[model samples]
Target chain A: MTAAPTIFLPEVPDGDDVGLAPSISRFELERFICGELPPERRAVIDRALAADPALKALHDDVVAADRAFLIEQPPLPFFQRPAKAPSWWAGLLSHWHAGLGAAAAAAAVVVVVVVATPDESNRTKGGVEGPRVSFFVKEESAARLGHAGEELKAGDQIQLAVKDVDKKALVVVGVDGAGSVTVYASESVQGGLSKGAGSPRVLPASLVLDETTGPERFFVVYGDDVDTLLQAVDSAARHLGDDVKAGRADLARTDQLPLGAAFPQSSVHIVKIR
Target chain B: MSISQMKDQELLTGLYRTHGGRVYARCFYLLRNKEEAQDALHEVFIKVHKNLAGFRNEASPLTWMTRIATNHCLNVLRAKRAPWHEKYKQEVDVGVAASVAGGGGAGFSLLENRELLRLCLAKVATTDGSLAELATYAFVDDMKQADICVLVGMSAPTLRKRLREFITICRAEIEAHVPGVVFAPAPI
Candidate 1:
């Protein structure tokens, strides 16, 4: 398995660790609702809650909400793709900042992390002019999206694309807002302990536009930190750059999951051709 | 072929006959509406036909169709912001609530606990990260963390971390809004 980009996570501060990390994504509470999670796992969670009264209170809320989601839902006319899905085609991407102008864009755009050590030798200082990278982030279950979309700020919409994200093994893009984009998927990017290396993840990026750089539009990538997220995105984009278009061809492989070597349908990727 | 010209309207009909009950049950779980579930049934079939051209010969047509059903139901939830639905309260086994509230699942009277908390959840789900709202649903239903991980694409460890954060927010939010519950200090 290929190694993951080394990221130093912060140590759990004293008084914060209750035998487990407290920080969690909304995704975990949702798995229980869909019947997707197993039983023993729930036991562990329950026992864990016995230690945290706060967790128990929150657990009660989750239980109520899950039941609510299972109730009759209102009419949703918008979730379906517009008759024709939007074109998520390939393109040259670059980073920009607030001070950047149209004139600066003509120079090769490189959405570098002002926070990154700026070791120009390893990464492209010039985004379009530099060598290619691969990156893609996927939000898997979205069990809570229906209710969550309400909180999405207008600027929160993070737009990312490559000719073919699936083609490459790794790719990276940059963000300006620093915390606007979040790479979401059902599994962790570094879930290497369980799955094999090279598992796909939707990585995030951000930027600080300036006189020499920055594109016309601005973006803010959030969730994971910007510099680290950008590094991972660069990796995935680079990896998949080869087969973004060809990647769709393998939508043929979803059947492999259930049928030993051949699973049945591959629905998510089919609709995500870029 | 046009929608009108397809012949396995017979097979479609037959599949519906044999599996419609089960499939509708799945749709109801997400949609929570009988009519909407019925309407979604039509759309699911249209989707089945549209994608049938690319259907690989791997899984049985039934398995493939069921997957399409599940995906479509999720889509329906997404398209509609999971609007509130009319609920039939008697069916769900109220769990500990039965012991505490002396009523069936709906009858459980933690009104003291549930009333203010439910409102806080509504506020956060509608405002903060909707992930919290989704988390509330799964946790209450007692879903495993792994299932939530698979469905939402978040790491399990990371998810565990998030559930804790959201709970803190919920408790504080409830205490501030509700009259009796003692709220924990918000995590910085």
Candidate 2:
């Protein structure tokens, strides 16, 4: 075999000649800002910033950018996995049900009443004495009942609890800022809603608000036929049309669906701010 | 103390408050798009959160996060499938020509120019992903070889060998793109 072909190679300059760009790295600046750097390193950065107007400007930019981001996108409940109901709450529920006779402790009985007294703070929009729906917001590891027409931002996590309604199926839907109607929580059209009779029981799954800005209206309807209720809600939403979908008109107008007096319905609306 | 002790939400919020700007800036620099940088920032932090336990005191938090962001952005660029050499053909050609005109066969150093460094990274990544990563620390970050060894968890000899392999690939790429252009043997 012929001799191996000679490979040509380029000459690399000496370390001294290699011109590494003279500038403060973003990483260094971040560590300095967060107090992660040693005092000596901080001094180095301080001197550099003082010596270079560009570096000073960059430092200011970094601070302002972080501030704006924090203000605009504060950590919301949806960012973390939905926390389970506290163990104390579960223990209390078990104890209360154990104390009451099995006959008196029907699954349909409102457990929320035993856990916490009902107040205006626990109610959603159009809070009434009889069968109704309420909303709760989880924040800072605590779940608080949401106020009527609460102003929430994108990424906020919310749970809906229904109370005092005896029905085979329950359907919950929301008209979002885009005016599109979505079924928030419900069972299959044929199966109806899950846990229809339990008063003040939270519906399964927490809803993380989407990045749409405007009014979002939610409707809770409970009845025997899930399909009919869905149809009625869909028809009413379509009737509301572009004005409601575009968020130009209020979603409350669809509160009185053609489903008539047969099915009980309640509505709550929230303003989504940027 | 390890970052693992912090709760997920608290850690995430703290990371965002402290280093989000720098990560976003790094992503934007690499990707050259504001929206893609924002998306990359969120993805990088999610990775940071997942790998929080692996964080050591040897590397500063920002240094570790920068490595993740750089790698993530490089992968994004690699996934784009755009021919980086072709994308920066004019700039590379002009740079090579200028370097050659200076005579003495000083050779062209891709490390000096960010665009050229990106082109080399994109080209080298196709053949060897790890080598491309090593090349990034050597060239883009201007990290010392010894520091690179510590950062990449490679011994000095291994780091040198991999870097040589990376430089070889980069040379071939440049030769293929700008025929007859000489390259300075990169200082490892």
Candidate 3:
């Protein structure tokens, strides 16, 4: 049989070399940077980098790229169990309906707004200031602001809006009476939720109250890192345990969620009458 | 934080700092779009974070990460139903014409021409996905047979057979794209 026709191709570049000149493998360089390498191995790489300008250049380029990435996407904070609310605050929460009524009468608004007491740890850490969520109920075609402990019917459409916070990412999760969780709104891969400067920003989507009867709490988790925000919300949900899921627990009076001080959080609590 | 927790944090931070760029580069190389690559980069890191414990034992964490990136991108390409070969049909035709006219024989360097490389990869990709992955290390990364064996966990003979199959598919694809152009199988 005749020999197969030769296909002309350039020599395969050595996998270990970064650029034109030969050097150590990229993995070795990375290990060096990470301080994972043994001292002797580190010395070898150091000498190689020192001797080869091309290797040094590659190292610098990698460092700069990682630096830019870190700047754009910062590291997530460590998880921490949230502190318990004071006994006095818990006592005040027991008279939540009376408090809500007084506040509503003072404002002369149809909606009763219940805002979570900001976590003191967050405040002490100088977290985002005045991060507040407003609840709105839809009646017919017109939507009105919603208030805390309002009797909402099944299938009533409601929405949430945020004001006085400038964060790169936001996630809103709802824990219904049945303890089933729903994500109302979240940041997209392209970027965070779109908002106008210094204006109350309504989320793009609205929620229709489910048939589950009892308290429905919406938690707003906001931070610069979307991944961390999601993790925090998930961790908090896990911490709520079976009591909330069994509909035996009132989330509003429950201790704050176990989110780090870095994430500014707020919540709106409403009751489903049906 | 506990001492163990602190160490875990440092390890994760170091991993991100050291290999994040290379991972991004690998993602961009395969996906060929900045936005898609960015999405893939985040996804790959999530996998890395989840598998962080296993990384310390890995002989070559970069290779392990590359495998993850390749698999993820291939899945994406499959999900999008993007015909990678069809997208670069015009480029292949033009390159073939240039090579024939210039009397450069019947072959060209695969890595030197990225469009052709992508076209070959698309043609070689199959339901198994291993063949395309093998082709990437063999052709794109230019890894040695021994290294490819270790990276992919295949015997040398199996690798040769799979590569031969990959070449057969690529040859058929090139002929189909540019009629009258017959490629001689290059040595693996």
The digit string of per-residue lDDT tens for model 3 on A90-195 reads: 2222222122222223222222231222222111123345466666766653457766667888667655666535677776666655555544445522233344
Interface RMSD of each: 21.0, 15.3, 12.4
Give the docking tier of candidate 1.
incorrect
- lDDT by residue (A1-274, candidate 2, tens digit) is 2221122342333331221225455445666776688988788788888887877886788788777654433332113211231111122222222222221222112233324735322223334543566667656545667766888776575656666455565666666545565554443322233343433555543455545566667677766765666667666655554566565576544444345656677767777776
- Poorest lDDT segment (10 consecutive residues) of candidate 1 chain B: B85-94
Candidate 3 structure quality by residue, lDDT tens digits, B1-188 = 22244345456555655666677777777777766876787677668767878887986667788789888887776665546545556666676556556554545554556666776775555454778888777776656667778787888778877876776676676666665554543344
The residue-by-residue lDDT of candidate 1 on A39-93, one tens digit each, is: 7866656565778776667657656643443232211111111223211111111
lDDT of 1 by residue, B112-156 (tens): 233333433443454444454344434433344664565567776
lDDT of 2 by residue, B19-119 (tens): 77677767876676766876787678768766767863435787788789888987887776556546656665565555555541444346555555666
Candidate 2 — what's its lDDT?
Answer: 0.58
Q: Isolated chain A: TM-score per model?
A: 0.19, 0.50, 0.49
Give, for candidate 2 chain A, the lowest lDDT window spanning 10 residues: A80-89
lDDT over C-alpha atoms for residue A42 of model 3:
82
- Which candidate comes out best when scored by DockQ? 3
**TM-score between model 3 and native:** 0.47
Q: Which of the CAPRI classes, incorrect, acceptable, medium or high, describes model 3?
A: incorrect
